[model samples]
Structure formats: structure tokens, C-alpha cells
Target chain A: MRHQTALNPREGDVLPPFEKTLTPVDLMAYGAATWDWYACHYNDAAARDLGLSAPFVDGQMWGAWFARQLRAYCGPQAFVGGMKLRYHAMCFAGDHVECRAVITSVSPLADGTEIEVSQQIEKAGTRVASCISVVILPATGVAETDSEHSAGKATEEGIRT
Target chain B: MSDLLSDEIRALIGAERYYPAHEEIGGAAIRYFAIAVGDTDPIYVDDAAARRQGYSGRIAPPTFVVETGQYAGNTPSANGYIPHEWPWPKGFRTIRGGQDYVFKRPIVPSDRISVRYRLESVEAKSSRDGRGQLLAVSLAEYLDAAGAIVATNRELFFLQPLEAGQ
Candidate 1:
């Protein structure tokens, strides 16, 4: 096991930004991996039939991106307890999108620290989607298998909303 | 209620269905999902690294449950895929609006899971784009082989009118 120090998150701290340019192949691979063969996501003709210029990225894919960002920032010991996302605009293949996150709140638990993060994906200067996520970072020497500190307990406590 | 929300559609609120269990989660499936999402987290692909982290084995990505049905005996509809069995109102196109997820536990390889979906609510609203639309909210509870709820997903779908040229 690689040793990782606990993430000391502070409210209002902004995380480093990352960017990706969506492409037809990337969209197709995502669809295949997720088993989402929605025609509008893979067929330009089908998208045009629905009044779109081209196939668009799946809204759920953003959730995966958000989780990935959280995992990258919080390290292997941190567990994403919950996430809420809202899609505000469409992003098409070939559009460059930037992802950003800011720590909103950090609450201390007996076995871990719960951090709330606000994240958004932007295409150009316009926002494409936004997300709120709850991540639990276990204290040093605490193992994730500890029943009391499980992600389920975090949701049941209504801390994710 | 908007003219687009029919009586039959309203009745769908609270409807529930259970999908069959998915095949045991595998290391390959987890790795494929992580790669597709462009995640480089070794814990999702390297069991030894995961064991060092104190997990029983390599764990699936948090959002991987969304694709579990792909491995089920009966392929279920993809997320946001409205079945034709529903008396869907015509002249409207359905699009995904958003989603929420609450993961209760780490999903490990060999865990067989199932989902129970319930229609939570349907509301009529004016979209920001100045179109009348129906916002449907549904909940999916993911269960493990022992019937414990492992996670839950809330999905939002918007049904809007087809604009000019559509």
C-alpha cells in the first residue's frame, strides 16, 4: 500500500483545474464502457434529427469526471460519500471543457473528516454542468472498513444534501 | 398541470420495478470503466495496491454502478432510457437533466448487485430556454446479494417540445 497523508481541506480553497477536449472516439468509448448506446450520443444523424448539430456528451459522464477529480484530489483513502449534479447546457464532441472544484465545507467526524466540494465543468467561459460532492477522508491510522465511518452512514445522516 | 402531462403519465409517479442481479463484478470491468473515464487511480485496477489501502480487493469506481446492468442476464434500459411501454406524450424529446448518487459502500469484485427503481415525482415547469417541459425524478436503490442497500441514484429527465426543424 502506498502511504498517503490525510488531506487537510479548508473551506473556500480552490483545487487545481483540469481540462479535456471531447472527441467522437472518446464519446464512443465512454458509451461502450458504460453500455449507453443512446443514438444521440453516437449518431450524428440521430442527433440532427433531434435538432442538434452533433452528438453530445452524456450528462452522467460528468458525474464520473467529478468523481475522478475528487479521487485525484483526496487520494486513495478518501471515499466519495455522495454527489449531486445539474446539467445546464449541452457539450458536443470536440469541445474543450475545463473542470474546477472548490472546497465548500469541512466537518470533523470521529474517524474521518467530511469535506463538501463544489465543482463545475465549463465549455469556453460558459458553464456546462455543476456538482456538489461529499468526500470522507479517514483520519490517520483509520481503516475504511470501520463500520461506523462507512459512506452509507454519511448519507443516512443527511449530510450529503 | 401542463397540457403535456397526461393522466396516465401522472399515474406513473411512485411506480417501482426491480431488475435482475448483475454478474459478479470483475477486475476487468472496473479497469475498463476507470480507463474510459480517464481515471488513473491504481486502486481500481491493482488488487495489491488496493490491499495495501486496506480494502479487501480492487474496488470499482464510485459511479460504476450505473453500468452494472450491462452484465445482467436481462439487459435493462440504459440510464434515462424511457421505455416505450410508458404512454409517453408525443411531440416531445426526452433529455437527461441531472443525477445524484449516494454510495453506501465500496463495491468490490465478486459482489453481485441489483437495482430497484421507483418514480418519485413528475412536475411541469417552464424551462430556461422558454419551453414548457415535464421534469421527472426517479430513484434507483442498488442492493447487494444479501439485500443490503449499497447505493442509491436519483435521476432527472426533461421532456420538452421539439423545436423548429426537429
Candidate 2:
């Protein structure tokens, strides 16, 4: 098992950003599974009629993407406690979307570290999904579990690892 | 109120599963999701860096499968997919109520996987303020290439029916 990341002050927190393109297949697959079958997602003509150049990706799908990004920094011991996202604009299929996140606040808690992170999903420089993630990190001074172990122990137990 | 059994809605939920996509799981799909949501952690992008940090390599963000039905299952729809029945009134917006995970193993790209989804269950309620509904849970199970279970996904949707322009 790994130890939780020690709380770092944002004064020196640095983040890496990257760009990715969503294939029409990816968009349709997500929509089909999530049951969020708004026509604008799989129907390009409908989307264009709605003012988009092509089929749009669902914002919830974008939100799910944001959660995964935040967890990368928080690590295996990271627990997403809360998440909220606002769809600022349309992200059409096959468009290049950029993702980025930065640590906003890190506070030590009784059992673990509380982290607040801000994330954004953009398309061709337009913001698609912008959101905040609240997570609980594994605490310091805890015994390491070399095998399978839940990352964050329930508050009832004294969490040292 | 409990209109789930209504013939119209069930027809939508019972559509044949769409093509379940094959994904590396930790690939760009995850990165895009992260970026769209605004996370910039190194683990999402750098394989060497994540290995240095003790992970085997790049991995799908925790919610990687939220949108992919390979893990959530898909059904063929004669009338098209009906989605979990939603019955909210006015200013109706929905969101993730919360999520809990029991990771049997951390997902790694080398692991071949797929998901099967079931509508699971639904709940509905009504009041004078208008009408409302909740998708208490939509359950999904992840399977390795050999057909071993890897993870489970349960999503909740809170629906508000009345508000304009949802």
C-alpha cells in the first residue's frame, strides 16, 4: 500500500495540461451508455440546427472526465468527496478538448487531508465544463497496507495510514 | 407516480446494447475527461512519472467509465433509449448525488475489460410544488477480458421536472 500525499501548499503546486480529441464513436458510446440521448449528441444535423457545428458531447460525460483528472493528483488513496460542474458551452464531437487542474486549497483534517481542486474542459479555447472537486486524501503516519486496503478509513477509526 | 412499468418507458430502457467500445481505459478518453473537468495531475498524463510515484503506470481517472456503457451495459431500442425515468418539476436539474467505490484492484491499461449495465431500479414521488423523480441507482459491473469482475458502478440522478429550459 502507498501512503497518502502530504498536504502541499498551493504556493508551489504546479500542474501539467494536455489536449485530447473526442472521436464521434467516443461521444456516441458515452451517450448510448449514460442514456443521456439528447439528439444534439448523436445527431449532427440536429446539433447544427441548435447552433453547434456538430454533435455535442454531454457535459456529464465531461464531468466524469474531470473527476478522473483530479484523482490522478490525489493518487490511489484519493477519495472524491464532492463534485459540481457547470456547462459553459458546447463541445462538439471530434473537437480538440483541453483539460487542466490546479490545487486551490489543502487543509489537514483529523483523519485525512481535505483538498479543493478546480478543473476545466475546453474546446478550441472555449470552456466546455468547469468544475470543483472535493476529496479526502490518506493521512500521514499510518501503517501501510501492502495488499488490498481501502484508501480512506471511516472517520470512526483513528486513521494514521 | 411510479410510471416506470408504463409500457412507453420500459420500451426505451430495453433497447439492445449499443456497441461496447474497446478502450485502454487510461488513454486520452480519461485525459480529456480530466481536462474537461479541469484536473492537471501528472498521473493522468505521464506513464513514467506515475510509475515513479508507485502506480504501475497511467490509469483511468476514478470515474473513467461513467459515460462508457461497456461497463454500464447498453440495450437495443426499438423506440430509442428511454433513460432512467425522470419526474421532476420546474427548474429541474440533475446531478451525481454521491458515489462510493470498493476497488478490488486498481485499474491498469494492461487489464482487458468491459462493463454490463442494468437499469437497476428507480423511485418516483409527487407534491403540490409540482412533480419529481429520482434514479436511485443505475448499476454496472466491470469485467476483465477473461470475464472476471473488476469493479462496480452505481449512478444516481436527481430530477426536477418543472423548471424551464433544462
Candidate 3:
């Protein structure tokens, strides 16, 4: 789907934050979706046996949240080329996690603009994970007027994730 | 550089094991995953919306490749997904350290992906509490029917020895 206004992101731009409260149900569904049925992610008893107070969110699930944040900030035509995620701490179910990103660099490509985004997932003020993502935004029509385009930042409220 | 890695484990480095093709990516699976991740993107759920975005059919979320093996009943052992044929050390707890992924192409419905796993490296490191930990780096390549890699995932796992007593 074509975005009404093309995104013209600049370096140092911080994307709008995406937040979600993960529950045991969310963890189970994420495990089912990713096929990462590790007991610590779903079974509370198993998690306690492993020294955790409760089942924790799968580290890989943060990657999906990062992708969702980028898709929300760059529009649907953008492609997520790569991502590097480093897990710092365990986030248990019921924690409210906020995903945030900042554009580190923006380079012009022949057909699109390549942007490196530094992303992080924070829970209760502590960083649970950090990520570096590369996204390629397709070269499309320029904004008809400067006021018409907010570099994709104006639609943050419309983003569901 | 540490003696934590046995010769058997060290020998696994650079060895690649290929698995059979996974079940075709279907619209239902894509939609299910999208919903699980709380993504309401229409391109992942509606074929018509995807076609409008230049995709032939509904596309999957970028990380969906991680689950393709599960559909084929390839449950992961303690060694991680795409297990090695050799026996892994028992009584060690496996912890995910990090993950890196490079997507070369978008995965769409009906795409049957074949996968291969390679042990990239293993090392001994000290955990935050000074316990000796064995770090294993594994690589999984998801290939299309044409044998071209569509995505590559590198997983970092830390195997920590279990302490005595429950």
C-alpha cells in the first residue's frame, strides 16, 4: 500500500515509541508463533525451577517488536534488511515494555534510503534489550508540500503496535 | 581459548547439517504470527493488500522464518534449533545471549523453505557472577526452492553448568 506521504527521515530522528504489556497469554502465543516452546517462556513452574520468579518473555520476541516499530515509523513499503539484538536482562510476563528507536545514520542508495536504527526495549526503566536495525525505505514521490509530510512521525497515533 | 570445549564440540565448528524443506508458508500461519506479535498490518493478513504492496500474496513477518522448522516437527534439542547430530553435554542450562538476522528477501505464502545449520564458533567466557560459561555461535540459513538464501540467522547461546542441589 502506498503511503499518502513519503517518509524523509533524517539522522538523529527518534521514532515514536511503541508500548505493550506482555502477559502469560502473550508469551504463550508468541511461543506458539515462533515455535520457541522453551518452558521458561510459558510454564511458571518450569521457570521457577530455572531460578526465575515467573515465566519470562522470549528474547526473540523483542525482535518482532523492533520490526513492528520500524514498520510503523517507515511505512509498509520499507524493508527491514537486518537486525542485531543483544539481550541484557530477562523481562517477565506482565511487564510493560516500551520499544524505542533512533536513526543513527541515513545513506542514500540508488533506489532507496538506507537508515541504521539503534533500538531498545525498556521495562520499568531498565533496558532489557538493545538492537541495531537496518531498514531500506523505497524512493517514492516527494511530499506535495512541506507541511503535508511529517517524515512519517505524524502518524504515530495511527500506529496500532 | 579455554579447555571448556571438548574436542567433540570443537570439531562441530564449520560442519553444516541440512534439513528437509518445511511446510509451505500459508496465509493462516502468517496471520497467526502477525496477531501474536500484535501487528495488525494488512499485508500480512490479506492477500489483496499484499498484492497492492507489490507482493504476489500475503507476506509473513520478518521473523517468521524462525518458526518454519517447528511446522516440520523439527523440535529443538538442548543444542538449539537445527540440532547437530553429535551428542551435546548434559546437565547444562542453555541461555540465549543474542541473535542477528539478515533478510535478503521477503517470505510469502506458499514458499517452502529449506534450512541448514552450521556451527560457527565456540568459546569459554566468564558470566557476570564469574562462573565459566561456554558460548556457542550457530548459524541457520533459510533457503528458497531455488537454493538461494533468503535469510540468515545467527544465534548466540551460553551454556552454564548447573549448580549442585535443587
Most accurate candidate by DockQ: 3
Which candidate model has the greater DockQ, 1 or 3?
Answer: 3
- The candidate that wins on lDDT is 1
Between candidates 2 and 3, the lDDT winner? 3
Greater-TM-score candidate between 2 and 3: 3
Write candidate 2's Cα lDDT for B50-100 as tens digits: 565567786655565444433333353332444433332334444444333
- Residue A135's lDDT within candidate 3 is 93
Under CAPRI classification, how is model 2 graded? incorrect
Report lDDT (Cα) of residue B138, candidate 3: 88
* Native RMSD of candidate 3 (Å): 3.8
What are the runs in model 3 whose C-alpha is more than 4 Å off?
A1-5, A141-161, B1-3, B75-87
Distance from true location, Cα of B77 in model 3, Å: 6.6
User: How much lDDT does each candidate structure score?
Assistant: 0.77, 0.55, 0.77
Minimal lDDT window, size 10, model 1 chain A: A152-161
Interface root-mean-square deviation (Å) of every model: 6.9, 9.1, 5.5
Give each candidate's fraction of reference contacts reproduced: 0.50, 0.17, 0.46
Q: Taking the tens digit of each residue's C-alpha lDDT, what string does model 1 give over B44-134? A: 8888867867777789888888644453344334433332223356677878888899999899888888878888898998877876899
